[model samples]
Target: MSSLAVRRISECFVKPQFSNQICNLTPWDIVMLSTNYIQKGLLFKKPATLIDEHHFIQNLLEKLKHSLSLTLFHFYPLSGRLVTHKTQNPPSYTVSIDCNNSDGARFIHATLDMTIADILSPFDVPPIVQSFFDHHKAVNHDGHTVPLLSIQVTELVDGVFIGCSMNHSVGDGTSYWNFFNTWSQIFQAQSQSENHEYDVPISRQPIHNRWFPHNCSPPISLPFKHHDEFIWRSETPLLRERFFHFSAESIAKLKAKANSESNTTKISAFQSLSALVWRSITRARSPPSDQKTTCRLAANNRSRMKPPVAEEYFGNCVHAVSAETTTGELLENGIGWAAWKLHVAVTDLNDRVVLEFLEGWLDSPFIIQMGRYFDPYSLLIGSSPRFNMYGCEFGMGKAVASRSGYANKFDGKVSSYPGREGGGSIDLEVCLSPQTMSALESDQEFMNAVTEFDPLLF
Candidate 1:
């Protein structure tokens, strides 16, 4: 691909138009204090009926900014920064919004001459897309100026790309999408000249009440001397990213195959898909027969909590559940074996287990050290098909395609999103070493079920 250049047109901080306040970080937020922020993005085709391209883009940018300012009125935590206590016991910390600082989400506008076809023509994510991500630069600016939310708007020749990064300490995928969808609603209303709808009804506003078990203790801050350094090793191999789409029919067939083994309960789309990908990745790596491989699944705990937390409750409420097996057993057996492994891990999550896990965090908040986010022997799965990323519409139309901008930063990381067609299909973003990816593409069994991503097909 030829080199493409990007020019920065504008940059500014967007503060909340409402009052500034401080919000305490609950135990759920502290659980992810050391994890990396999550990155989500959307791609939209340029409106076909526009007569003036320049005016359309200018109005779109301004509408987004105005809608975001109103969004902060409902979700003010996005305009806040995390602060750590210096002398308090257990070093208590909270998210605070100060009136004297540039305390708002970063808004940026850049122009690139590339077209949508340039990115999707090869059926692979281009390296140039990496420039769209902020790379978490200067996140700890003097340990005082950190923005919880940042947005980048890139205008393409035939499309527009919207990328956002949210600090994981403030919310999980559910909360992140909540803010995005709500912002889209506000923007849609503005596009229709319904400015009065800016004030979201109380029923749809986010609930900030952090829930904890009775007799909960304050979580201690984990100490990491070099928190700014990348967790992956410097000598890691070069990696490549690819998108894979599974149709509703393909998933149903896999589900049938998984359930045929036991002739009992059937596995879910998530379990079947994860099993297929896990096996494909394991084989591509060509690990030793005796070596063990692990798959860490990001499990949401909102429903697992006692009495169940409200759907609108914001903050991080996810736990990592791991499934382990020897490469020999995984390959020798069928996909059913792998699917069962994932099913059990999710089924084991319950109220008692979740409560005990939170209590343990308060007693010892040690940031557990493990393999890099993209370890060769381990695979990490992020996001879920349940999140309706395709439904995020900002008046122009629904997104043609949606993906995570940071998926390529690490190898062996997978992020799944609901298919654009919205009928139980799935789109997976897989990252792996270049050598491993080449092998995976050639594996007949793996490629047979895999389909190249095409927005129109969905």
Candidate 2:
């Protein structure tokens, strides 16, 4: 593998449409201040008709930057910086986005002498993939100094990779992917138009007004005087990250088996899969039979709200719904029981539950930290199989693979992506301790359900 080389780095700002805009962070956003940045990327095969790699890359970079500038106009908050203010009387801290002094998003261009196959062929994701993103160890609150959004475009020997690192405090997974999809739409529109400077209209207009329950106000101040009081920084443990592919057939089987064994029809495909993962990982770890294990999943609260928020509401609108059980019961009762438990947790997370969580946050403001929110004994699942990960063509072609950075990675962190084959198939990006991962690979029952993929299929 040849060394990676940096070609250029610059800033891309939103089109000058408006000025002096400021968005206050709500409790949903405030809770994410101490969390890791959202880092994700897509892989695209180089155009076959291209002859001059240098010229192709240069043109692609320019178009991407321009399209991003246009996209940022709709997502202007992304280009702004997080401003922290200290209140004297109350002696608290407040965070907000200052659009007037926007620094714009960071844009990086680089080149690598490796094929797309080199990235997708491995069972274990190559560590080099992490280098494609910026702000590796930074948290969301670092948006004050670091750009709220960072994009890195790496030209490969046979393909290209577009990686982005966005402040988690600015948005959740829904908001993250909405920005991505709109950006790609603008890029593709530019490619087809004769005018290089054409401004395309966005398909879905984003709603910037932060959501909060009645009687709850903006500028929610935290009790801490300094961010360091709640900020968490720890050494990451040795872990192995691998992609587990579940075909549509396998998904059906899991769902059917779960529902049949539980003797209920309320189980969903996601719940069934989650149950399988929870049980399998528990069995692999072989924890004490009486030990308590938990699984927390990020649930989108848009539809769960009484008066549902628009799908395009552009901020954090998710809450972590969790299920807990004893290792002995989870293992003995089988995947159906485990999945049923997950279903109940999700079903019970109605509008009242979401309102309660927000109300409690108002009384006592705090941020999510590593050791406090998650640990090795539990699992934290984020992202969703429904996201249009493969739809980001950018006029080059359909994405061949999807990857994420090491910003918020920890043992038992799982991110889900839509499978390349589509049609209800799903791919899980699982991270676990080396010992647990080794055990998971050797577990026949779990491996039997995973769909084997040929590297060339990617």
Candidate closest to the true structure, highest TM-score:
2
C-alpha TM-scores of all predictions: 0.91, 0.96
> Over the full model, what C-alpha lDDT does candidate 1 score relative to the true structure?
0.74
Error of 1 at 116 (Å): 0.4
Clashes of each: 0, 0
Model 2: lDDT of residue 133: 89
Those runs of model 1 whose alpha carbons end farther than 4 Å from true positions after fitting are 88-102, 135-144, 194-198, 217-237, 368-374, 456-458
Please provide, for model 2 over 1-458, each residue's C-alpha lDDT reduced to its tens digit, 9 standing for 90 to 100: 53654344454444435536899998899888888899999988888898887788888888898888888888989888999999797576789998788768888887777788888888899888888888888989889998899999987888899999999999988899999999999898888886655457778888998887797777777787788898887666888999999999999999999999999989999999999998888899999999989998889999999999898999999988999988999898989999999999999999999999888888887788875667567898889999988888787888888899987888888888888889999999999999999999998878988998764565
Off by over 4 Å in 2: 1-19, 90-92, 195-199
Candidates in order have lDDT scores of 0.74, 0.86
Model 2 lDDT on a 0 to 1 scale: 0.86
| Candidate 1 lDDT over residue span 1-458, tens digit each | 46677767997778767646655555666545445567788988889898999999998998889888888778877787765444456443333333335458888898889988787767568877766755343222222356778888899888888988887767889999889888887777777765555465533678876665687633334443344432322332466888888888888888888878646475787898899889999999999988899888889898888798877888778888888999999899888889999888888989888888877866765442223344577788889889868878875588888766642246788888888887898888888888889998988877887755578432
Considering summed lDDT, which 10 consecutive residues are worst modelled in model 1? Answer: 135-144
